[model samples]
Target: MCARIASPCVGLCSTTLGDSVCRGCQRTDDEISEWMALPAEQRDSRMVELDGLRERVAGRFLRIDDEARLEAQLKRHRIRFRPEQPPLSRAVELLRVGRDRIRDLQCYGLVPLEGAVGLTAAELHERLSARLLEEASRRRRALQACTDSHC
Candidate 1:
């Protein structure tokens, strides 16, 4: 049997932002309120969706071959990070630093993808930042629309 899925609350609730969605956990206010009462199958499906969002929004930027390489890169760049943190959070910190310091990401095993190819480190960082922001904005809008329609 599969283990019971628990709430995705990261303790950084942002429901007060008036977006209906929690910026930290990505769950809408309604979902958050009803999480405990949700059926296992429904909860599992939501977890899958949240996981996909987490990966697309944050983990996609991490192109390292392994976690050790990522850790080394963080150390080499003097970027303070917690190994215990989620990969998404770590990737956010790693990508927030100046591109000059992390220009040669390949040296740290971060191979650029087709879209990132030929782009400078700064350009890649900007692209990733924009994508993250866009995703958040899209989610907020979606949640708002759902709320307006009472869905």
Candidate 2:
């Protein structure tokens, strides 16, 4: 779970169960374990990576109109989210916690974008989170490939 600090751990970490990608924050097991120990520069780099990933996936289905409203709703609902993350992440957090109950996206300052219509909040969250994970895995592989090639 996202803490008051810059860490993205959602507290419901599944990494301790031997999962590679944490079921809660979607971070890898290594990321969760090393986050606190990582240097500021490294943590900042990881935040940049997560922000980029959220933008790519969240932008596909949601748009933010009033970031303050999104922030308010997240706080009101006790949803965990990173202040360091992009505004779009607020909407993602809304879905993550209110998947079955979100009645009006407008209330959360979110506008349903392409591929979002015809899907319930639960469905959209499912798709978005799955896509986010897929994108992360793809980027990780690409990075590994480049590193392995000594590029």
Q: What number of clashing residue pairs does each candidate have, in the order they appear?
A: 0, 3
Task: Name the TM-score of candidate 1.
Answer: 0.56
Worst 10 residues of 1 by lDDT: 81-90
State which candidate has the highest lDDT: 2
Each candidate: what lDDT?
A: 0.67, 0.79
* Residue-wise C-alpha lDDT for candidate 2, range 1-151, written one tens digit per residue: 8544477665667778876677566677767777888887898888787777777789999888889988998889888776677887657767888999888888888888878977888999999988977877676677678889999
Clashing pairs in 2: 1-9, 1-10, 1-11
Error of 2 at 89 (Å): 1.4
What TM-score goes with each of the models?
0.56, 0.84
Q: After superposition, how far is residue 79 of candidate 2 from its true place, in Å?
A: 2.0
